[model samples]
Structures are given as structure tokens and as C-alpha cells.
Target: MLAHRLACTDPPVNLLSRVQALMVDFFWDRMHWVPQSVLFLPKEEGGHGLVHLAGRGAAFRLRFVQRFLTGPADLVWRPVARALLEHCGGLGLAESLFLMDLKGLRLNNLSSFYGGLFNVWGLHRKERPECCGSLFWLLREPVVRVSRFVCGVGPSLQQRLCEERILTLGQVVEVCVGPVWTTLQAWPHV
Candidate 1:
């Protein structure tokens, strides 16, 4: 039930912390020696298997992101989620999410739902840096024009690329090179 609520809402941090402390206290039932985090580990790992509310909340947020990305095309929440993402920087949902740096966004100005979702997503990406090398993932990275690699490239170029439907490095390469670039040998990492 609490998981369901977390999926739909972002509870206040103080409230979550308070509830966590209460749960830990009840579990301990007296003076405790182990750190609270150890309690969240599996019993086989030499600690009680207790739920960590904040980690659970973050898991719920990641689940929401997974659904948002791969859910049925007709999902009722898709449009609302897309609109929320679009509001962040007026960019398309994919661009705002994958191309632009998540830290650069004004996350505080958005609803907690998206703010938390993006935060978790960013952390996930950072934790698994290998994901950045996958062909599908690399394709979503920004081109040199929009990326920090180039100097003095203004928004006009980005706008032009958007107008030309070339928002990513993959698109730019496809346009400049040829469709033959899709061969597996072309990208060793892939």
C-alpha cells in the first residue's frame, strides 16, 4: 500500500525519515548496535531483511520510469508524463531526458514526481557507466555542436538540427556519412 502511494506521490522527506526512524526503533525494540542500513540487508548477509523507505521510494520511482519508457503506447499516463518532461526545457521528451545533462535542469521547479524520477535516472546512469557505451544508448548522446566539445556553437545550430530532425550524434553521422554506417563492424563497442 505504501509502495503504491509512493508510485503516485512524493512524500515529504522529513515525514519519510520520521517513519523510517519509527520502523527501525520498533524493529530493534531496545538499544541497537548495528547501523540502520545494515538492517536493510538480506538475512543471509548477517542482518535482518528490513525495508528501507527511501530506497523503496527510489525503486518505485525507477519502476515508474521504466513503465513510462516501455509501457503500452496507449498508456493513460504517457501524455501527462511527456508534458511534464517537456516543460522542463521546452525540448522534446527524449532530448530533455537523454541528451541534456540531468543536473543542468531546473529540477526543483518541476513536480516532485518528475524531479525524483530524473534524479533516480541520473544516479542509475552514473552507477552503470557501461550503459553509455551501448549503441542504442550512444545514439542518444548529443552531437558535438550541442555538446561541450565545441565552442561558440549557439542555440541556433541546435534549433537548426532539431528542424532537420538531427538531434543526436547518430543522426548527425547518418546524415554526414551514409546509411551504410549501420553495419555492426562500424561500431566495435556495439
Candidate 2:
């Protein structure tokens, strides 16, 4: 029941810890002789197969992200998800997920739920070395991701850059300063 609930919603950390303690206490006669980590290991590995709630929660969120990204475009939750993404990154969900400088994300009004989702997605992406360094990923990476002063670049600048279709580092290098200046006439420099 708890596992199923975790798939849909994240429980508070303290609550999860309490639940884990209770489970551990129930498993042991009186005292915990083994480390919690060992208990979380597989039974085949000489430890009881304990379900790590945090890891399970992350897996569930990652699964949801997978479905959101690859599922049919008409999914019911897409609009809500897209709105949240746009609010944070000023772009579509897919575009923001792939192109936004997530490291420098501002969570002023955003919920931590989505923040955790992004962290899980980032970790998942990093796990796949081929995807992290792939041509497609590189081409989709926002210029700010590689910027030295990433936090210094405000959302307005990032949005302006996106509006001008200067999304990636490759695009920034290829674009002519004249065109950018043409659109941003008030700006002294391109």
C-alpha cells in the first residue's frame, strides 16, 4: 500500500524515516545488528530485501517523467506539466527539459516535487554516458548550461535568447550579431 502510494505522491522525509524504523524494528527481535544499507540489499546478497522508500519514490517519479516525455502528446496531464515547465523555463516541457540550464533553475514559486523530478531526470541522463555526450544532447543544451556566471544570466535574457532561436551554444556561435541587434535594438551590445 505504501509503495503504491509512493508512486503517485511523495511522503514527508520524517514520515518515511519513521516508517522505515518501524519496519526495521518489526523485522529484528530486539536490536538492529545490521546496517540499514545492508538490509536494503537483496536477499540473495545475504541481506534482507528491504524497500528503500526514497529510492522507490525516485524510481516512480522517473517513470512518470518517461511517460510524460515519450507518451502520446495528448496525455491529460501534459497541459498542467507544460504550464509548470513554461513558468520555470519559459519554454515547452520537452524543450525546457532538454535545453534549460537546470543547474541554474529558479524555484521561486515552483514546487519541490518538480525539482525532485528534474534531479532524478538529471541523474538518469548522467547515468547514460552516451546520451550525456551525444550530438543530439549537445545540440539541445542551452548556452547558459556552460556559462561561467550561469546564475547571473537572468530569466529575461534567457527568454530573449530563446525567442531569437539562439538556444544552444552551437546556435549562439553560428548566429550573426546583426540579427540579434536588429531584434534587440534597445540593447547596447549583442
Candidate 3:
């Protein structure tokens, strides 16, 4: 609302305050339960910051945010991609994969959940040798798995910790909501 007020009021200015307000709403508000530390700092500063696996339904939220946080989200993702690509330059695999951190995420907001997934998929797909294969399907594999556990949905108390390091906004979705997607797939992996 402050952004709208500043953007519309008086002389019609694009001041820093208004811009900042919009960015905050678009990014921070979207992520359901992340602290200020993850939201504000760059990935280099140590925060996965994406919304894949924070809670019961955060995957859905991250997925929504992944699609809609268009303007600023795109900008924020670019630098992270560049950094990842630069770091993985020597192996000569063309594409790089990152396993992000997922802790303290909320599940009520759809935008934050989906938004985080898109960021993860987008970042990994960058400069990859394979262009036609969208990272959406590739990342979906882990995300669907993690979401099941984090959401507390499809378990009778497993006696093991499955792929925990694969936690991210995407993996959270995998664990939390993997069951839902499995229904859609004829050969869904259990």
C-alpha cells in the first residue's frame, strides 16, 4: 500500500522509498516464514532464501511466487546464477546444480512457495548445455519427495532421513506435496 501511495501520490515520483516498498512486498512478503537474515542477504551472505521446504505447505507457496515474482525476482536470480556458473566453470559440464537450505519457511502464502521453486529451477537451468529440457521437470523430482515429509502428509513414521541436503524451496515442495503430483503421474515413484 505504501508503494501504491508513493507511486500514485502528488508529483508522481519513483523515489527510493516507493521502489523499496514494492520490492519488499514483492519479495519478502511473498516468502511465508523466512527471517530478515535470509530475505535481505544475497546467497553469498549465507541463506538459501528460497521457499521450497520450510513447512507443511511452503512448496505450494514457493511455486506460486516462482511464477509471479517476475520483475525483481528475475533480477535477483541473475547474479546468483552468474556466481554459480562462474564457480562451476572448471568441470566443463555446462550446467551446475545447487542444493539450497530450507528452514523456517511458512506455508499459507502461495506466491512465496511457488516463487521460490521457479528461482531454483531458473538458477540451475542457466547456461546449461541442455536448453530444451526445462529445469522445471528436473528439479521437480527432488521437490516432490521432500514436500511429502515436511508437510507431514504421506508417512507412518519412516525410520530414516531421506535426502535432507536436497532441501530447498523446490525439495520442500517435493517432500510436502509429492503425493499430489504422484497422482498425476502414471509412474510416480514412492
Q: Each prediction's Cα RMSD? A: 5.3, 7.8, 18.3
TM-score of 2: 0.62
Residue 154 local lDDT, model 2: 82
Instruction: Provide the TM-score for each candidate, comma-separated.
Output: 0.65, 0.62, 0.20
Clashing pairs in 2: none
- Best-matching candidate per TM-score: 1
Residue 92, model 2: Cα distance from true site in angstroms? 4.7
Give me the runs in candidate 3 sitting further than 4 Å from their true place: 1-74, 77-132, 135-137, 143-153, 156-163, 167-190
Candidate 1 residue-wise lDDT, 114-181, digit = tens = 78887777675343364465666566666533343364667677668767767566676678776635
Clashing pairs in 1: none
Assess the local accuracy of residue 176 in candidate 2 as a C-alpha lDDT between 0 and 100.
48
Mind giving the per-residue lDDT tens digits that candidate 2 earns over 7-119?
Answer: 76768889988888788887775577877788888999988998878889999888888777678878998778768866775443354364344765565556777767777
TM-score of 1: 0.65
Higher-ranked by TM-score: 1 or 2: 1
Worst 10 residues of 2 by lDDT: 125-134
Quote model 3's TM-score. 0.20
Models ranked on TM-score: 1, 2, 3
